[model samples]
Target: MADVHELQSLLGSGEELTIVCHNNPDPDCLASALALGRLAAAAGIDERRILYSGEITHQQNRAFVNLLDVELKPFDPELVVDRSERSLLAFVDHSVPGANNAVPEGTAVDIVIDHHPAEDVQARYVDHREGAGATATILAEYVRDAGLDVDATLATALLFAIRRETLGFLRGVTAAEYEAGGFLHGHANDDLLAKLSTPSVSGATVDAIADAIDNRSVTGSVLLTHVGRTSERDALPQAADYLVTLEGVQTAIVFGIIEDTIQLSGRSTDARINVGTVLNEAFGDVGSAGGHREMAGGEIPLGIFADYTSDDDQLVAIVEQVVRARLLAELKLSEEDGGE
Candidate 1:
């Protein structure tokens, strides 16, 4: 159990606190930040800011923010400097500062609340549980333990966060997550959740899915596809989710070029192979990668891809081949054996 009382004690009177979400925050991250903000306010903290650095490019995520009315500020270094003496920085959903967050390495962090695998993050207070499906689950525990009143908005956000993170209890979920869901179900707005879950998709998303289906390759139960250059990076994950539902597929690896970097998203139904560790071992040398047991994502700069070829088609081909081969190898499925 995490200690909410200790957290309350950390925020002294009149001190400012800033809660930061990881880059490209999803529903889980946003919800966790909002819940924490409320907790801080309840603890009598006068000044608090919820900050995130990356764009919320996913339509569902954008809808969630707008519909839920969760307030977030764009991260500004000036804010940290202005309140340096009185500021206490806390990270939610992401533990490693500068790994996938805007915070730089070596900067002091006051608190870390996350459900991701633990890393060596130096913070005054840390609560990390790898078993929990969503960070929002941890936040829900805090709200419940402290006997804090969870309004409809906060309840809906937390409930939605758990659902999204766990894929409706289908992936990487534990008993605690179910309990958290049950707790939030009574308080959350069911109508708002229905609206948030089913947002309108753009033409780009459909085109991306088509590209993924056309370009997909199968090896045993693994499906690999590159959606070429996608305008919306979120479409990669959506494509992966769709691909994994295919009859013979137990794992899906989807990648697309956005801006200058190749964005990767993977989903796995097989419990034996940890998708997060596979991604980390395969791409950690070249770029950043890590997540939960069932789903993970990564990014590699185009400069690295450019090292092999300058031709656009050749670059895409080489990237696809290299990434697929590396992933398959990591999953212990040989090309000859996995191929249909």
Candidate 2:
């Protein structure tokens, strides 16, 4: 059982609290932040703020927020964060600093609530468990254990986040996630949940998919693709996830140049491989990146490479080669000798 008293004590102290999800607001992130906010409110913390850095790319995520009427404000790095003011910041779903879903410059993080393994923590209070399927699941447990009344909208958000992050309980999830999922299943709004499951895809998403599929190159069970100039960084990971579902594919790597950064995402359906290790081993020195066993992502600064075309294909090929080599090395398959 969590020490609700500790969490409640943190909230009841009249300190300003800001709840933030990673830059790209996925269902799990959105759900976790809102659930935390709900908990804080129950503890009489009325000034709690939920801030987001990136836009909601998926229709389902937007719809989920709309249905829940969650009031999330856009994160402006310029919003003066006074360190001396004794403010508290809590992050959900992601742990890395400067991540797309992370707060911009000049924000102080005080607490972290996450399901992913802690890559690095600058926060004062953190609860990180890689075993939990979704951050929302952990938050759900907090609300339930606190005996707080969770509304239908919040329950729907939790259910959607748990379902998506766990891939309907087929991925790296735990018993606690299942218990929270069961609770949400009983209370969530059925109509809102259904709508979020298969929301309408925008033209930009369609174009992004076409480009990703068209650029794909398959080697063994791995499919590598590039999408250029993505307005939505989260779409790259989602696209990589989509490619892994192909008939012959067991792993997928997608790269894109968003602004000046070379972003990469990797996914694997196979149980024998850990994509997180592949990313950390390959790009850890260049930039911050870490994630779960099967899925991971990272980014590299483009300025390091010389005379790079900055074209999507060229940039992707570079990132892909690095990731592929690292994955092969992790799997004990190399260019010189293919081990049996």
Best by TM-score: 1
Local distance difference test scores for all models: 0.87, 0.76
Model 2 Cα lDDT, one tens digit per residue, 1-340: 4566787777776456787767667889888888888877887777778888757767777877887788888885544254335466778887655665655543567667887766566666677878787888888888888888878888999888999988888878789888898877888889888888888778887788788888887766767677866766767877988999998887787877777777788898877767777777767787766688888888777675525664666766775566567656665655554211
Question: Would you give me the overall lDDT of model 2?
Answer: 0.76
User: With candidate 2 superimposed using the best TM-score fit, by how many Å does residue 299's alpha carbon deviate from the native?
Assistant: 1.9
Backbone clashes for every candidate come to 0, 4
Candidate 1 wrong stretches, greater than 4 Å: 307-311
lDDT of 2 at 307: 58
TM-score of each: 0.96, 0.87
For candidate 1, the per-residue lDDT at 124 reads 86
**lDDT, residue 303, candidate 2:** 72
Compose the digit string of candidate 1's lDDT tens values, residues 1-340: 6898898787654377898889989999999989888888888787888888978989989999999988889988766545566588889999877888887777778889998875786788888888888999999999998788989999999999999998888888889899998899999998999999999999988999899999998888898899887788899999999899999988899998887888899999987868889889999998889887789999887776767676778888888888888997898887786555
